[model samples]
Target: MAYSYYAYTPSHTAALVFAILFSITNAATVAQWIRYRAWVWLVMVVAGFMESLGYIVRTVSTKNPDKKGLFVAQFCLIVLAPVLMAAACYVIFGRIVYRVVPVESRTTKFLWVPPGFITTIFVTCDIVALLLQLGGAVLVSGTQPTQSNVQQRIQTGKNIALAGLAIQIACFGFFSIIALRFHFISKQFDKRLADKTTDETTEDEKYIMVNETQRKVLKNWRPLLRVINVACILILIRSIYRVCDFALGKSGYLEQHEWPAYVFDAAMMLPTLAIFVYWHPGKYLPYLGFRLPKSRRENL
Candidate 1:
């Protein structure tokens, strides 16, 4: 017989904790975006905002696990929000890659666009899945018995969302590999250029010092890029963890146990916020040359 009601007490509480944290993080990011006029910061803020809403639904489910309607809302919004955040990371990093990589031989000026397109497609699937599951759950709730068939349909819609996440993960892995490879290439190219600069150093000492100083400023970029890259990778890891949660026979941790539920809520949401806090690239965004939409510029 199909199981009825899903959720654990501790897990629900954990979800609320994550909810509050992300809400604060998003609000701060929104403030930063207004000050800086950057689209990427806006994207991150929106994702965190949506995640907070999803967590609110999970908090509701703590009281009534049988409220499958709320359960679907909790799953759909919370689960999909981070992918949007990851996409923001991809765009910001790609733009940096263009600026940081030595121009003479840079091969990927447009690297960010394709990933953006792919993420947009994946999110579209998530939107379709969310509507289907939310609508289906609402339909299931009205029926007296809420037949097994309805449950199965609800689960199927979730699979669609899960499928989108899975594909997005693969996209992330691809981007990670590309980012690492690009870093290595930048290193090699910079090394050769450095050697040439050293050899060409003139008897006139002032010119060499200027070039060396510029080199130091460029080198400072590596550490910051690494921090941003790691943050993005952390989100990818959380997505993998989520795939394990949903992809496994639709294992509702809410149905089988509480620990997995808490693990997911606390482990997954915390790092993204931490990353956003650490890399707060609000200052460097002037390099993007992105004009704020008229409304945003006017707001400031």
Candidate 2:
């Protein structure tokens, strides 16, 4: 007799909800990309597309739990999609730090820890992590009654996937610390300067100075900083959940239950994507020194 374990039937309602959510997010993201000419955010667009597709696959799987192909497709897409989103976040934050943050305020070595270097290292790691996860999924897809080594292959693949998730969590966590440090140092430096200037200036001068400062910070860096941090944290949590799921082995509570996947994966990832709709990096990249050539700018 074939043993049926954590491979329970998926909920139709849950799949539908994710499908709708991802679709809406995808449309909004595409609109943002088009309106802003944010070609750089193509990676994010690809991530959203994968997420939508994964949910749609999940929706199909709900109707047929025994369909191995549906399970594998959804598995690969959902697991790897966030890697691309995290990469996009790294690129955006790196550019923001390089352009907006004063060289003196940054604790990291500007030459070695430049945004480009940080982005490159993390993105490379994300690619490696993604490949490891996908490879694991492939290896585990052979689980069937007739397959003698199915359990071994599945266990090995799960371990590889867990390692990948760990790497992702570590990368995101390290970058979050770096980002928070830079934010704190810059704000502290700005505050001290403001205090000295206000003490020395006349009332009228102080008012103008304070007003201008507020406008500058609000318009330039604050919103992007908040959105990026929140998005990263959300994805980090989702990655951590995935790590636990894999850690539990094949029959783990999280892995066996469809609801956990919906909550940790879908709910967590949706907000991360939605955050970009309002604070699309394209809207602020121009302020970060990213620009088209004069001729191109004029034509647009």
TM-scores of the candidates are: 0.69, 0.82
Clashes (candidate 2): 0
- Where is model 2 more than 4 Å wrong at Cα? 1-6, 103-107, 110-116, 188-218, 287-300
Candidate 1's residue-wise lDDT over 9-69, tens digit each? 4365576787787777777777767765665566677777778787788788766666667
How many backbone collisions does model 1 have? Answer: 0
Point to the candidate with the largest lDDT.
Answer: 2
Which ranges in model 1 have alpha carbons more than 4 Å from their true place?
1-12, 108-145, 188-219, 250-255, 288-300
Summarize candidate 2's per-residue lDDT along 1-300 as a digit string, tens digits. 333322676688988888889999999999988887777788899999999999899788767666778878887898899989998888787766654544454334632355336778888888988988888766665466568887788889888888788888887888777776666655644554354343334432232133244212223455787888898888988898888888886677876777888778889899999999988876655532234233221100
lDDT of 1 at 167: 65
Number of the top TM-score candidate: 2
Clashes per candidate (backbone, < 3 Å): 0, 0
